[model samples]
Target: MTALLDLVLDAHGGLRRWQDARTVHAEGSIGGHLWSLRGQEGILATTDATVDVQQQRLVFGDFTGPGLRGLFTPDRVAVERPDGEVVAERNAPRAAFAGQGPDTPWDRLHALYFAGYALWNYLTAPYLLTRPGVVVEELEPWREADEDWRRLHVTFPETLATHSTEQVFYYDTAGLLRRHDYAPDVLGGTPAAHFSEHHVRASGLVFPTHRFVVPVQEDGRAASEPVLITIDLTDISVT
Candidate 1:
């Protein structure tokens, strides 16, 4: 294992705990201008997400409307009623976003796919660095937040569903992920800077409760305005 990877995994509650985990549950609300821009406002205003620990699957409870459910996997996104009546579903959902720009409005399936894959990756990082088929290299240190943060340039294989094939993660001295940079393909490769903060532990794992995404500036820094997405998590549990 790489030295930095070891530090990161251990800091985030360790690989052993993660290996023993089957699923993670968190209650949170996601909001920002991006929602309104994509025409998916209020879908996740007050919802709970259940992530399958070892698979790229996430289900949002009461996600689309009153007493509805949203299921997201790498290959499919569906909205169903509480009794399992399918309201809407799409196959190969990523293909539906082809040739789209940041301003292009997304349908409900598009929003579900994006939210599912994005959070699945975010909630399982560093350990993701340890997964098979992932390439991880320690890059030159980055100076941010008045400290020098270590950088990891990660390349995900086709098997992983994520924001992009390649991403850069910045970790503080304590090995907590502070910032992540990527160009989201669904947004026509919009360069974005995602920040995670206020980490707390649940079921022997660590996670950030307050997270936000902003535009990446020309100088490789985060812009101060126009928050694209904000997520506030609470009551996180894993088993």
Candidate 2:
């Protein structure tokens, strides 16, 4: 299992290389018209962040023209603004973030990406056991020509909401997650939904470089709410 885990890590960018460093910085754009974030436009802002795993500290500065400053660790979550006014504060165990839920698409997307990108060590590190009741399955090789990609599927055993029955994750030859598929939590029900994204290796970390959210709509028309959201990362560096 440890060797297999190493394969997975190497497939990403090498665990040894990433774990060797205590802090990493990333600049990226998150949430916009693709996700139909009202009043947000392309490149809503650029962000600079530092994560210190040993100290369990995160501090990020946003240049999106005056907004939130955030710090998150296993024990606490704090937020402030450009004016140095703390806006929110919370102290809770990290486990609280992993409860079963009646989730919306937004919920699943956020939970998956946030957990996957920021805390992959917690999920895949050999020391920590996999979440209970969450069965992990290894899939056969599959190819998508349009995207010029091949994948290994990782299936989740649990459902998302009452209806979210299936979870499928795709990794490239390198083991970085490229897509997520969610299906109805029922027998022979609605089709699966696909969330496809791209990742860039910045600061020895693979973060979402591009993302598109696709809803399985019956009418083939745009969703009442934005069915698709895309984020493009730029100017990433660690200080």
TM-score of each: 0.97, 0.53
TM-score of 1: 0.97
For model 1, what is the error of residue 55's alpha carbon versus the real structure, in angstroms, after optimal superposition?
0.8
RMSD of 1: 1.0
Task: Give every collision pair in model 2.
Answer: 11-174, 34-228, 34-229, 163-185, 165-184, 165-185
Worst 10 residues of 2 by lDDT: 120-129
- What is the model-wide C-alpha lDDT for candidate 2? 0.44
Expressed as tens digits, the lDDT of each residue in 22-124 for candidate 1 is 8989898999889999988887889699998888899998887778889999999999998889999999999999988767888889999999998888887
Compute the lDDT of residue 215 as modeled in candidate 2. 57
**Model 2 lDDT at residue 235:** 52
Specify the poorest-scoring 10-residue window by lDDT in model 1. 122-131
